[model samples]
Target: MTEHDALIFLVALATLLGMARLLGEVARAFGMPLVVGELIAGVLLGPTVLGRALPDVFQWLFRQSTPQKMLGAYTTVGVVLLLVVAGLEVDLGIVRRRGRSAAFTSLLGMILPLAGGILLGFMLPDSDMKNPNQRLLFALFIGVALSISALPVIAKTLLDLGLFKTDLGLLVMSAAMIDDSVGWVAFSMLVGPMQGNSVEFHKLLTMGGLSLVFVAGTLTAGRRGIDRLLTRFADELHGGRVLSLVILLALIGAAITQALGIHAVLGGFVVGVAIGDSPSLREQTRATIHEFVTNVFAPVFFASLGLKVDFIHAFDFRLCALVFAVASVAKVLGCSVGARAGGLGWRESIAVGFGLNARGAMEIILALLALEAGLLKEQLFVALVVMALCTSLLGGPAMKRLLYRAQEEDVVALLRRGGFVARLNATTSRGAIEELVQILEPRLGHLAAHARNQVLEREQMAPTGLGDEVAVPHAAIEGLEEPMLALGLSSDGIDFDAPDGKPATIVFLLLLAPRRLDEEVRVLASIARSVIDPRAREQLMEARETEQVLKVLAESAQRIAEERRARGPALADI
Candidate 1:
């Protein structure tokens, strides 16, 4: 409340944010996630490195001030917003479409680690447990902690590896989505009991029931209502107004959940899911909110972790290693086995397992919450953070290496026999993807359904509609020797959510092989460039036969070749 406190809080905030951001950018440059650098920043600024080296300075900044409480309130908002972003990333529709594979992956992926964590919790000596009396609670916390996946990190890793739109990527993403959903729900339910409530059998049972209802209601009724509200205000909700609305709803949701004896993060998460599910929601708006929250609030939240604990004192290498080993083995094996059961190739299945193994920021957030709630001790919290950082570092490179292979090929050459659908009867995106996959069934065989799921999954991530009535639904598949291309011409023209709001008459379903990211980009560019001219598009549209469409494509390819040649070999990287 004093001016001195305010001055210290402001100074501390500035230093933490500045140092964290600098390191985050440095981490990005080195191909690591921002959290890795942020963690380092925390260790350096907190009691670990800084306190040891500069005791007086650390004391003056932290010991003399009552800024920790104020920082806690600020970080609470930061965490709420972060969870909202996490919720926005969860696409329930993708999980639904993934169906059996996702179900199996999520179920087994969750169970193994959860069981492993619980067993680990029990096996550990009383010294590790914050309270030996609440061993069950501690065990359950560990279980939930180990079970979840960080959707943001997984998605980013896939994107960086150019697998975000691939069949393999979709499988990993869907499985993670389910794991996160279930894990968070479990965590929310346990938060109340772990914080202070009686750990009686009856109370836990009641909490479990309430949590289920809360999640179910939020996803079903709340999601629909939020969709309607966004639709009604789609005109007014833009720019600063939209940003304010997101913050407002997140706070309200957090408050409600907190009042319900659950963690406030649940409310924010549910609100995000609801807002995100709206068909009317713009990608631009989502990006704005994501950027603002992450760039500003996220750094503060992560940096504040160091101030709360002495990492050097709390860290137990044996325990940390044990947690990491159990987490990695359990998640990888469980997800891989389930993926194999669901018909993925052994290589692709294992890659999915690795992809979903990344814990990232989610684990840190969970661990921090449990520590603050008195459910976890500093030792376990530190171990969990280290585990998260290590797994995040491992997941991407391992998956990339596992599925590596691709090359540039002409779009025309990639097209298979009988791949052209003269008239597409389907109007909806879902229906169109299925129809295209059915055409691919002879060659793709069992993969037809998988292909369909990935295409739909990619579509949900972003609209594939290129302007001038051309739309491409595509994904790069693992273990593919070559790209697969199919064409569907819709006379009625189907909406593909293009920026121009134009329905696509020329729809191409393209499946690429992973690893040749440059080749993939060139292929997409080549396709988009084909219909760039109105005259060419008009000519292609008038042609009733497949040969006519081929002619246009061939001509477009010639033009592209000419352009590439003109650009000279020096510009090849571009």
Candidate 2:
């Protein structure tokens, strides 16, 4: 490459990164998903806006072949990393907890949308398909596109609504994970054996067989091998080496899948799932990887969406509106019906529908693949992108409202109820428990001693530590007529045998009446969800005063309530 070309590539990369980050922050400030900003960043820089307004400069910066290649390389790497992180977010254990509900919801969600999309494809004009003669391929592409759900978007929305660790949240995430896994396999078969206008069935079967073997191998033997590798590195190097190993695993996985005729992202995702399932994986390590990927790779990848096609030239308003309506209605009704069939309540089913309806980044990625494969015309691709964005924006607000209606005050409010300890003078888990019990002594008298004994007994059975420097030590007592809690903050974390290997910095001492077992479980779940966000957890860890901690929790609760009220009832039609 010429020196001139290299210089232009560097400048373009810097500009794209800057614009994507700035816009992403703007999207988050407005309570939208980060992808919205990233996509818009691409649009602004693409032919639709910047290129149109400043033709010469835009042409010089992006129209050059070298600059395009550089941008493509960045996005390719970024996409692999993004997929790996998305896979890591999937928790099969959570899916198992919901059991039939997640399975049924995932199945119905895929079927109805697949049918609707295929029907819509047939309904479109020959002009709407990039390869008019290949109607089956186009129809299949549309079906796969509509059948998938975006796990990252759904998970973030659930977290924002303070339901990330709840039964409903787990069900939604697990269903989305299933949809993604199935959708990718279907996509592999659809696009892997394309030879001009024809698809070779024998080649498709070969690719399908390879993909199944890859998935099975990754989940079983591959998972065990990666776990051992990570453990050995983590035990010795103890710091950045583990991060390097994780990235290396993603690269290896991407290479294997790409060579096997499946997309490279699938490989990254499968490896990420294995990494996430590892028993020795640390929360701090996970957090570091997440922050880096979310800040750097994700923004660049999403922004790259705009660089391929001009939204203005590719968009057909009527087609865009129609496609959006079909995708949203089909998913909502199908998922809602499935959830109800699985024995969920009316409101819960509707909430699940909204959660799953979020197409977000995954749909955009699939649409891009179909466009590249010549299965979809430019207008149709733009329509799918539009549909994805609209559905993504809709899901979060809708689910928030549904959750708000069902929201009630709980033991979490004890942060505000005045049993807050600004500092804990304990270095061990047992000592922390004793300190918390003493805080309750003034009110409970001799009952405090009994509560301490009960909590210690429970701890012996299993640690209450939920990782992320948080623990909930609770026990039911005979004399208590009401539930009580003491919130303790420790600047110096205590040893609590947390699953993630993090020390306990924030502890909740909970006491419930003997018969209120159900309430005790619910309260514990609520606390877990509320503190899942790293930002919130950090705030709790750093607060100088007890009231400051209360303020943080109160503000989050208030934000959710206000947003829910503003949106009113979360209906399918909306």
Candidate 3:
């Protein structure tokens, strides 16, 4: 490339990265997904906005074929790294433990969406019949698109929303992972015909044999060999050997699948799942992969996807309407029905559907692949991109609303039915002593307040601050009408004798019945753990009024209660 061209490319890369970071921070500030910002950055840099505004500058920066190809290559690497990291971060044990539910949810979600997308494809007036098999391919592509639930996006969303450690979050994440796996398998089957390969009995048998061989070889021989190799290198290797080894394996695995006529992503995913399932390897691999992918490469992938999206084409109102309608219906019906059938309540079922509907990076990648393969028209690709963005944008608010509408008393009842709450009151702040006293003092006599203050003062002698800007103050009180909790917030923070020596701004006062020490302590511990969440802590600190503080506290408590209930009568029976 010429010097001027090289300079332009560097400038473009720098501009894109800066835009991505700025947009990401803005999105985070507004409680939105960071992906949203990356996407917007793409649009701003693409043909629609900035390109239109400054045609000469846009041409100079993104003009040359070489630069474009380089960007695409960088983006592809980002995608591979993302998938590998995603695979590494997954909790395979949870999937195994919730095998039945995960399987059921994933199957129903995939099948229904696949069916819906196929049916929708048939309804489209533009669909051609000259190549009957092409139609099937189209249908299958739609199904794959509709059926996919962004497992990584969902996990990040749940974690950001403070739902990751909750039952609903866990179930949603497990189901999404299973759904993605099943969807990939279905895609493989569909792609077979597109490749001019028949799905004969022999083919099926051969595929099955290969799968079995791969599993056995990877699990037994492959894992052992790698384990021994790593053990040997643990002391000798320091900086980049571990990551270098993983990348080598990932590429080799991808190559094997490509040679086998299946997509490389499938092989990469399988390798990830296998490595993730191994406790000894999972953390090390995850750390290495995340460090490389998220910090170094993810922006390029996101930007590349952005570059392909033609906002001008997406702006066609008629196409946008159709895309939105089909995508929304497929996700809601597919996941909601699946979740309900899996025995989730109406709200939870709806949540599962919305949560699964979020299609960000994955859908965009799939659409691009189809476009490049000549299986999809540019217009159709634009439609899909629009659909993916709409779903992703809608998911957060839908989930928040569903969670907000959940009745506290109903949650308490569920807890009781599951055996978790023995004579529990809705007012109990999960055994928060100070919160309980604050809630009860207005209705009680002065003597009660004095006694409560005495207990609190004595307990305060040995600070409850565990550091990290968190403090748990508790007191044992007798003859309480009901267990109560008082949650307080101070953004400026407060001084506490914490191990970290940081000032504790967020405090949870646990008020436990004198005799229920064990149960109350457990409850206090749960609350304390939840409060440590960065987002949750931020929300607590930002709460400007009592109502906001109470809202945050109530949501936290409800999440804890629901999680305990979903543990299947063990914690509930306590």
Candidate 4:
């Protein structure tokens, strides 16, 4: 409130943000997650290093409630935004596609680690718990902490290992989403009713009922309404407006949960899931929201993790080791068993277990909240963060050590029965996509709209125009069993915004099954190589009939297959 306090707050924020960003870049350069650097920045600036070395300087800069409060406000909004971004990664359709395997993996994954954590919690000294008598609450807190998966960390790991679109990658991601969802809900139930000075059974019961209603309404009616609204305003909502709308949604969601005594982040997360799942939210818009939040706001919050706790003074190696061992063993065993039950081979299942073992940002966030809530001791909090960082760091390398491969197919061979659009009535890109989607409607059935939207979303990310007289519009659709292609000929030509400013006379609507990143890459490569040439485009446009189009493509496919055979298996295969 004072002028002196205001000046300190501004200067301190500048220092934290600058240090965090600098260290984050350093971490990225060293092949570590940027959060690692950001956390380090906090550690150096906080009590761990700076306070010990320069006590007076540290006190002068930070021993003020006004600065801490100002910083807290930024971190709070930052965290809520981070949660929304995390929710966006929760693809329910991916869950459906992976189905039984994901369910089994997530179920056992949560159970065993949770049990191990509870046992570990009970065995700890009475004085070690934040509240000596709240054994059940502490145990439950530990259970959720160990059982939860960090989806963002797991995703980045999979991507780094080049397995993100493989069946195993998709499987791990799906299972992790389930684990994250369950973990957050369980955490809220444990913490929500205990917000006041006293904990009561009636309050817990009330919180439980309210939580169920919130989740159901959000997923069903809230989810549908949000989708329709976004669809209606898709054209109008851009850049600053979209960013503003997302923050507004996150805040509104946070308010609802915070009022119910649950953490505000859950509201943002639930809203994120709804918005992210909507086909109307283009990949471009998603990326914009993601980049801004993660870059600007996320570092500040993750960095604050270091500021709050002294890693050196509070760390109990014995306790840390015990927690780490129990969590790791329980999670691996549970997930591996579940994966096997879900029909994966033992080796692949084990690898999947390791991949999903990463606790990452989610664990750190949860641990901090519990610590602030007086449910976790400082040593326990340090141990959980250590475990999360270790698991995340190890997951990618572990998956890389294991073999990862997906079945590859030739796209041209699938045009035998259907997927051939000889002459298109639509002269615009959007109309072309709609017409093609309708042609494949019988096959896609309920997923036709989903297919169309995904294609449109991908298109919006980057124009698919191949720069000749050819354009390939494609998307990987969830639940689609196989690759489908619809070749549409436009005599008047349609503008696809190609690099060379050439209008496309031949358009290929390619639909690929989800979890086939390799297949998608190969098919696109084959199409670009075969049809992007001037002569090939002229031939395709000249022969606009279905039979002639098939003949030309079939020949091209044969030639391409022979060339690939001569060259041997690609580097990706190896």
Cand. 4 TM to true fold? 0.75
Clashes of each: 0, 0, 16, 0
Per-residue lDDT tens digits for candidate 3, residues 1-574, read: 7776667677878878788878877876665666677778888888777677897877777767877666666676666667676666556566765566566667777787778888876666554322345765677677777788777778666644545544466568788887776665555545445554223546645655565566457656776676676666766644477688777777776677667766666666666666665534523345556666765677656665566656775456665677678777777877788777776667778877888888776787677776666666666777777777778777767776676543232212212221111111322222333444545465445635754674456343334665567665555566644344545554555554453556566655445455432234345435654564566677767766555555665577666667766765331121
Q: After superposition, how far is residue 228 of candidate 3 from its true place, in Å?
A: 5.1
Give the distance in Å from residue 522's predicted Cα in candidate 3 to where it truly belongs: 15
User: Global lDDT for candidate 4?
Assistant: 0.81
Local distance difference test scores for all models: 0.81, 0.79, 0.62, 0.81
RMSD of each: 7.1, 6.1, 11.7, 7.4
- Model 1 poorest 10 in a row by lDDT: 565-574
lDDT of 1 by residue, 295-384 (tens): 999988998888878998998999899999999999999999999898777877788899899999999999999888887789889999
Q: Which stretches of candidate 3 lie over 4 Å from their true place?
A: 1-9, 127-133, 188-241, 281-288, 406-574
For each candidate, give its TM-score against the true structure: 0.79, 0.81, 0.68, 0.75
Q: Which parts of model 1 are misplaced by more than 4 Å?
A: 196-198, 405-462, 465-471, 475-574
Q: Hey, what RMSD does candidate 1 come out at? A: 7.1
Tell me the lDDT of candidate 2.
0.79
Candidate scoring better on TM-score of 2 and 4: 2
lDDT of 2 at 246: 83
